[model samples]
Target chain A: MPSAPAGTLYRGREGMWSWVAHRVTGVLIFFFLLVHVLDTALVRVSPEAYNAVIGTYQTPIMGLGEIGLVAAIVFHAFNGVRIILVDFWAKGPKYQRTMLWVVVGLFVVTMAGFLPRQLMHVFGGN
Target chain B: MAATVPDLAAPRDPYARRKTTRSNYELYGWIFMRASGALLIVLIFAHLWVNLVSGEGVNAIDFGFVGGKWANPVWQVWDLVMLWLAMIHGTNGVRTIINDYAERDRTRLVLKLFLYLAFTVVVVLGTLVIFTFDPCPTDAAADLLPSFCSSLPG
Candidate 1:
């Protein structure tokens, strides 16, 4: 019979999504980081070699992909800062709701300010 | 005559004082986890789709591919944004787990100290790589290079 587990992994008001996000994103970033470091080593191989690898980035679709990347980065960074404050500082969690709203606000504002420049560049705007 | 505001400053509960000595930090921490996690799902999956699915899949990846992506401001900004968000989210999640698990205050401080150090190293290095990546070196065996090199102005 399918029913809610007696011991819910996420028992609090905070849903499983963020907990899962935090973990998943962490693992993804770590894996990506390894690939990134190795890739950078290509520069030491030769500039042309490096350029060849990088040349694949030039596409409008890829530009769209970049938009998603920024969203991930922004949310993760903001949330990470929040967690750091809560852990190191005793009173950090007191303002959790306020902080959550603030993070969202910041994410939106930052993306709005930044994404357009990306669009213009990808479209070959001056 | 009806009372205008009925002691507007009066406490809601006669038993509870208006100025309690309680701090609401845990409340915020809990909320942050849920909110950030929700946002991470979209960001993470989209990243996967672009890198692993769209176009030539992972095999299409190379110096040229990356160079091509970053050549446009869109991917550059995209990468930059992803770096900042994920780094902060992961760091914060770890910090929370550490606080709950760590007992000694000094121990907590040391753990976080190292965490901050690692975070700094990653963010700085990542930013440098994204902005400063130069795929085309001045002197190299042109034959070994990608086809695009032949087109660059000598």
Candidate 2:
């Protein structure tokens, strides 16, 4: 990949990186939502069928995957708010960089709160 | 002689003016994303809390658990609204992404065709499942059904 020359407008700064991250997370969450709806639709089948599939979600591997999925969701959600502010707030563009950091900060705090609880649920014996 | 100042807002060439036929579809789409996004944060966060973070967490999410939740009209509406809003939000987001990256028109069309197809299938199926869901199927073992199912008059 060719490196960008100096003085480009975007220059891969916080603004560009945040935008890239938002797009990536948005697409990931959308695909997950598709599969989630399909899996949920299985309730129309039989209870046994539904349980059998949802059971897979309880496994350790999928539990870890859930962490990643939730991480993506949390980031996407916070960054989405940032994007809204950037569009609507009078001072948003000026504070866009600060808001990106705020988004990251909130993501860390949210994951911190969620991780241990989820980890215990997955690994802690019933 | 003083130079005459031209109005910046005026068209450079009156004969070159193009007829405007733009609709506000994209504008509405932009507004919808922000609006739906704010609502979805609340909807999905509550959804995750109740389903994944409460009780036994993921392990608590069995068929009966779902049946129990959907048994309430509140949850039913909550889920129905969530389903519609989330699907539309996600579909529009993906559409934007496709429009951005898909250089070829045909590729964008094909991708969006599949995207809309998936959206329709999921939305329709989910709506049906939410409305028509039977907490207790006749053939299912009694233990597998939600507690409320037993109290339900046969």
Candidate 3:
């Protein structure tokens, strides 16, 4: 039997990191969707309850949180499509890393397009 | 004294790990994931655009706003589809994670039990809310009703 090293840093490649990020974002989006469902369900309880619940989300802090939620969604969706391509396409695995970089580039561009308008909604003087 | 005997009833194939004979379920799930992801992009972005990007943005999301949107069958269906697809997709993703990480059968069972329960609750409640929502209930206590409810001609 071979003895294992005391401390082994398993440095994973881009594919591994993308897998990790996919799982993380997936879980984050899961919980967020749960809360969103419950809050949206407030409409059934009473208008007061619904309005009050939604009103809490209008704060600047929640605005930032919404940005994070959107980021999670964009990453998960983009990576999810990449995963599908990898699973089904003939040349997918060979260019998986390139696909990951493409996902990241799209994520950055989408967020840049989204952030200014979102920040203005949050911080622009009304 | 009874002799201790080694158990020999188990299957001899050490590599045999209860493989699924049904391949179509997974194939369908994979297809569903991509199909739903594509649709969700449109549904979610349109939802955000209507609710937060247009008009007064997030602040416009109130009882009246939601009521007005739900008053239309189109928005109601859009929201219903979004709720179902997102919940199902997320639940399946987590189920995959649980299967990968949970070493013990009992642990996997318990975790998925709870996951399914939560999924059921969200889907059922969300669907019911979308379909059955009454923005202006005549029977509601006047104090609990939205201010606009009083103005509508009965």
How far is each candidate from the true structure, as Cα RMSD in Å?
Answer: 12.6, 4.2, 8.7
lDDT digits (tens) for residues B1-154 of candidate 2 = 2467764656655666577799889999999999999999999999989987887899999899999999899999999999999999999989998997787789999999999999999999999999999989999998988998888787
List of chain B TM-scores, one per candidate: 0.73, 0.87, 0.78
User: For candidate 3, what is the DockQ-based docking class?
Assistant: medium
The regions of model 1 sitting more than 4 angstroms off are: A1-126, B1-39, B143-147
Give the TM-score (vs. native) of candidate 1: 0.52
Which stretches of model 2 miss by more than 4 angstroms? A1-10, B1-18
Report the lDDT of model 1 for residue A123.
62
lDDT of 1 by residue, B21-106 (tens): 78987687667655655565566557656764455544456655666667779877877876776677667767876786687799
Per-residue accuracy of model 2 over A19-94 as CA lDDT, tens digit each: 8898898888888888998898888999999999999999999999999999988998999999999999999999
The digit string of per-residue lDDT tens for model 1 on A1-126 reads 543447645655543455556566565555455456545556556666565655545467766765666666667667666666666667877876566678779889978865766666456432
Cα lDDT of all candidates, in order?
0.65, 0.91, 0.86
Supply every candidate's count of residue pairs whose N, Cα or C atoms clash at under 3 angstroms.
41, 0, 0
**Candidate closest to the true structure, highest DockQ:** 2
Query: Please, what's the RMSD in Å of model 1?
Result: 12.6
How close to the true structure is residue B71 of candidate 3, measured as C-alpha lDDT? 77
DockQ by candidate, in order: 0.10, 0.62, 0.54
Model 3 Cα displacement at A116 (Å)? Answer: 1.7
